[model samples]
Target: MRDNAILVVVARFLIPLVMLFGLYVQFHGEYSPGGGFQAGVLFASAWILFVFIYGLDTGLRVIPQRVIYALASLGVLLYALVGLLGVALGGRFLDFDPLLDAPKAAQQTGIILVEFGVGVTVAAVVMLIFLLFARRRADTVAAGLDPDAADDVREEQQ
Candidate 1:
């Protein structure tokens, strides 16, 4: 797959479209069937597909693990901060009515922020899970370690 020029060429063109559609879904959920969760999964799938077509190193270069963890924490914090902000504005937790002069505007803004935060968190977690699983499998395969053959391996070493 890595060396397949056709696949690589198609991916280079298609991955961005997938990402754009994911973003569209992220924002369009208010009026449609998609939402942060769906968008996040779409984004994560694109990243994983990119990795599969390219390589782990390339994927890591695009988005390092440290950034992923930071964003994961940041997303939760962002969501929480939005709630706290509402409280500070003399409303209940997550009360968006006080976010702006117009209650409708406030509600929309708050909802957007909430969705963005959720999307970020989901994307980060999914990417981390995929990367970890992919890395572990690669490691086991590379090390010639089979879980079922562990006893045989130890016996041979002995």
Candidate 2:
């Protein structure tokens, strides 16, 4: 993998652009079709591309397993906290009407926060799934077993 200089160089240039686009999709979602789901996929894709190009070990080094787990939990907590805070403020769950003095501002703030939470959770989960599968493949190959065969065995059991 290290010998592939062209792939390494191209990934270095493209990954940041992909991330920026993901952020755009996330922040601009309130006014556009894209939102947390799209942004999360984009972000996960960027990291997936990185892992595909650079290897899973490198990807894990950049973002550890514990960090991914924490991010997944934090995202859900963030979303729940926002809704609970609204309730505490005397509004219905997720109402966001009392978050700020101006109802419109509060709504906007609430939407953005919820969207961000969704994005974070989605991205973390996708990454976690990919990592798990990648690890399984690596282990299978290491054990001299056919990964496809392993998949077939699991499917047959199911």
Candidate 3:
């Protein structure tokens, strides 16, 4: 994808930092207002920024859709598994006491794990949405059509 040289350099430096911040938010959520949902979106937003400035194909090649889908499913599964642990221990859903035999530290650990799962799923889903929209726009452009053109122009010729 072609972009101004300065913008490319800036993005290269910024994206990694943004990803790191997301990780921090995910891990430190227990003591802060930010948590899985916010961290996930932030992580996905960095990727979206890259895609928007460069192109969808570049983004797809960097992070394939299949991988994203897998990650999303895995995240949900992880969260469900954690909750199941609580159920197996004869507690209500997501009850942390069962996670570690009623130890507060263990319960905190369980919560962190579940929160990470949520963050992963949310991030992957958001990225997937951005990918879909960007890909559609790229397709339209490749067909020699402006995305914002009138509906009549976008219609296929008989």
Estimated TM-score for each candidate: 0.89, 0.90, 0.85
Give the per-residue lDDT of model 2 (tens digit) for 38-92: 9998999999999999889899999999999999999899999999999999998
lDDT of 3 by residue, 29-64 (tens): 999888899899999999898886688778889888
> Cα lDDT for residue 124, model 1?
93
Task: For residue 10, give model 2's deviation from the true position in Å.
Answer: 1.5
Each candidate's clash count: 0, 0, 0
What is candidate 1's lDDT per residue for 58-135, written digit by digit as tens? 999999999999989998998999999999989999999989999889998998898888889999999999989989
lDDT of 3 at 59: 83
Please give the lDDT score at residue 69 for candidate 1: 97
lDDT of each: 0.90, 0.92, 0.86
Rank candidates, TM-score, best first: 2, 1, 3
Ranking by lDDT: 2, 1, 3
Q: Which wins on lDDT, candidate 2 or candidate 3? A: 2
lDDT-superior candidate, 1 or 2: 2
By summed lDDT, the worst window of 10 consecutive residues in model 3 runs over 149-158
User: Among all windows of ten consecutive residues in candidate 2, which has the lowest summed lDDT?
Assistant: 147-156
